[model samples]
Target: MTPAVTPAARPRQVRRTLPTEEARDLLELVRELIHKEIVPVADEEEAAARFPREVFRRLSGTGLLSLPYPQEYGGGGQPYQVYLQMLEELAAARLTVGLGVSVHTLACHALAGYGTAGQRAAHLPAMLGGGTLGAYCLSEPASGSDAAALRTRAVRDGDDWVLTGTKAWITHGGIADFYTVFARTGAPGPRGITAFLVPGDAPGLTAAAPERKMGLGGSPTAQVHLDGVRVPDARRIGAEGEGFAIALAALDSGRLGIAACAVGLAQAALDTALWFTAQRHQFGRPVLDFQGLRFMLADMATQIEAGRALYLAAARLRDTGEPFSRQAAMAKLFCTDTAMRVTTDAVQLMGGYGCTSDFPAERYMREAKVLQIVEGTNQIQRMVIARDLAGPPGR
Candidate 1:
């Protein structure tokens, strides 16, 4: 067996205990790609609030976009554990890229997992292959975490379906090539919802201006309006009235993605804090030599490690086809909160420098805040875990 790279040998490397040689090789490739393509331009592109469409296309060309899905339909055929660890590395480099990949995976779930065989053959290739992007539409203006309360409606019009309503907080809202939309099709509540694959250029489908976010300005988040958008019956995923279940299922994996991204952000903050303290001298000694500051770095490192372990555990369960919802919720809640604390402390460690955009600590703190809110809020994650623990809301 070949020896793995050690901290002394690869100082800036993210040490991973991967399950396969292929996975390790893949990680190395990802890091090289980040250094060559992403890192040099991430700060500039983000500052300009420019989306990295070509970067995503390059990633798709590299097969990074389809890592966890089966390969027969143009995916990478890696396990979720491996795929999410890749996400962690990406997030450490840039949040917009990491979360964009996550949302794209979530968008493909409906068709990849439940679409008719014909549907998969027709669309999965382009979506998972390259040059095409997708968005998942579940939340609405009035329904963020109360996804079941969404007002989007899909009415039957003979052999076609007409979708109407707005989907809020949609990542890649305007730039996506397709949208996996869930809308009311039956009566009311979760059971009434049906999912559809709507083309981004469909008549009456439009995007509002992107939101001015606290961070991740490079990511285009906006409300996607489905104003009488029409699609063929063949576009509907799974059986009618199954959209809520599908959305929740997609969110389980999505939560783990957020958790992985959180760990990566926390890890990045810790790395910056370590480097900052080591180089700066106070009282004629490196600040890292001070016990108080040393303890802070220790705590930050411990929290990041714990978060990585928790999210990886959840991802492994997903790989094994086990009941992982509760674990996913726990990972999402704990990891995001850890990110918030660690990033804040990272800024404190760097003192005034950290608070400025010149350092990444302040930016990491802002980015961490959003992870706690998306993929179901931390509050909602608690609810999901509690419901899993004590049974459903009613029984």
Candidate 2:
């Protein structure tokens, strides 16, 4: 036999360490699941705008859906930092799935943070587990980013409240098992708003035709019509006049989820670009070999890495229970902008192929634009940051 040939040394495992091992393991599990289940069917589902209800059930079965809430409520009780990482990984593969998680988490927040003990005990288990999915109903035809202007009305009759209004751009509009609805219970201002948990099957509740969106088409977004929908007083979250505060706080946390998604999308674009550049030829050489092209790739990679760092820093602050609203806003603003830049560059790097549906760069570009708009517009994020720097609201 020929002299024993040593097998080529296996590539060294990077062994990147997160702040917590548990979080790292969770992220790895999410990545594995997305690659195996979500990625394979993403394109087809997106084309049809079909909500991946089964995939969500599978995610729930994995206990991924219940993270970031107390274990008593059937949640995984993981910290926000870990939860955000999972969101990042999911969004990187398919934004619809990522938004589903964010919407569910927001629903859970109303119950976990503000609900009465009876409400928590009654609804938390199903909501946190794979058995039920939840939606946030705050935006209306008159209010999108200006959520405080929602026109939904809730009038008390004896022990029951009759709700009437249309909530717009509701994720999981047609499929959610329950809705965390914010309706006017007092006068016509933020002080009048009150939060409620309305079952999906409640009489007089219906979802309009889903909105045709530029991206994230796999998630159903539509107007939720509540016509004479009745809810029990027991379902109210916190006291009256607390709705606006609760909504704002939930958004502070939600922004971080969007930022994480942006980071993942940018990373996907960078990875795809790198792979394409390595194989595509130009002028008798690989496109990646040219100095100009190489610099563009370098800049793209740097932006993605920087975006990741910013989101993680904000996440850490959140996990530690620090005042992280400004940090969260900053991360959302920066990461989304970076995603737009990197994905656009990715398309340019791939030349003709990137602009076509044969590749995902164009899709990635469309998705990146929505990130800048949702959770809160990038302009709103800047205002939040500036306000924080200027001190309190009155200051």
Candidate 3:
């Protein structure tokens, strides 16, 4: 029951509706950058497991790294919707860059949304646009989904807080110039937590060897160990016990970023399938000419469009200052699930070739698996949605 539309002859040229000509121009610039700087080297860099620090620097220099933030702080002053669409474009080219940007944005969220005016004025310009990468440190070796249970501790000293613990599965872990760390300052659990902006090179702060991830190998994921790493009270984000609330608020926005990335990855997989099918001969004609394969591609495109719409709709809610936590959860859940399905189908459409490393289908499929797990798992998203719908389980 879906209408068929002609696919773009080239990927990353999908049609869009933007709020302003500025947004349209920004997207075009992103596509150009992705085509020139990201896509060509993506497979090779990922294969070599090389972290593209230079790519991030380029993104930062162009102001793409801080699009969703305010222009006064050296950002592009774009809306959430515009920023997310740009994420989609980057993700279609390479997940490392796209998700890396998302993680960096997540790292900045606490400071941007909850920091004192002095903190923002002092740090936002550099953090947003001064060619520095950032990591978010919420997860630990034990506490991932249950973030509030984090064991990292921050003890008050005369003029500083000494932090000690291990933060696990941190993107840009070893390479980031800064870290947004959540540490326990009082009793256990969420309310006892506090957020700190810790310099990456602070004394006794170190990163473990990068994890051997299933995909996005070009981006580093490592455990950051903080042993008596001292941070000034001036660096604390929000009140003494407001870190968990700040973190939750940040995640609400972060989920939408993940959703956009998922949609873009799906679009990439679908594009790959489209190109391969149209060229591969089956019997006397192209595989895409077959009814079954055609239908499969149709479904893939349909799913991609639906996912895009879902994320964009949630982003619009955020742009308009609405409570979008539930919508964010739904978009994250549906778009990531769609990415998994579409990437799997892309591989299926390519037959044995899809399973091989020579093509991108297998890689996209692998990357899709991670999306469902990050920014809170799909299971968590479902829980969030259910709680919004029927109140908490006890109620």
What is the C-alpha local distance difference test score of each model?
0.90, 0.84, 0.91
After the best TM-score superposition of candidate 3, give how far the Cα of residue 106 lies from its true spot, in angstroms: 0.5
Tens-digit per-residue lDDT, 217-311, candidate 2: 88888899999999999988999879988988888888888898898788778777777777777788788899998999899878877887888
Evaluated against the true structure, the overall lDDT of model 1 is 0.90
In terms of TM-score, which candidate is strongest?
3
Model 1 weakest 10-residue run by lDDT: 2-11
Please write out the lDDT profile of model 3 over residues 1-395, one tens digit for every residue. Answer: 11122222236488888999999989888988887888778887888988889988999998999999989888899999999999988888889888999999999999999998899999999999999989999999999999999999999998899999999999999999999999999999899999999998999999999999998898899999999999999999999999999999999999999999999999999998888887778787888889999899999999999999999999999999999999999999999999999999999998887888878889999999999998799999999999999999999
How well does each candidate superpose onto the true structure, as a TM-score? 0.96, 0.93, 0.97
RMSD of model 1 against the true structure: 4.7
TM-score of 1: 0.96
- Of the two candidates 1 and 3, the one with more favorable TM-score, higher being better, is 3
Please estimate how well model 2 matches the true structure, expressed as its whole-model Cα lDDT.
Answer: 0.84
Query: Candidate 3, which ten residues in sequence have the lowest lDDT sum?
Result: 1-10
Best by lDDT: 3
lDDT (Cα, 0-100) at 3 in candidate 2? 14
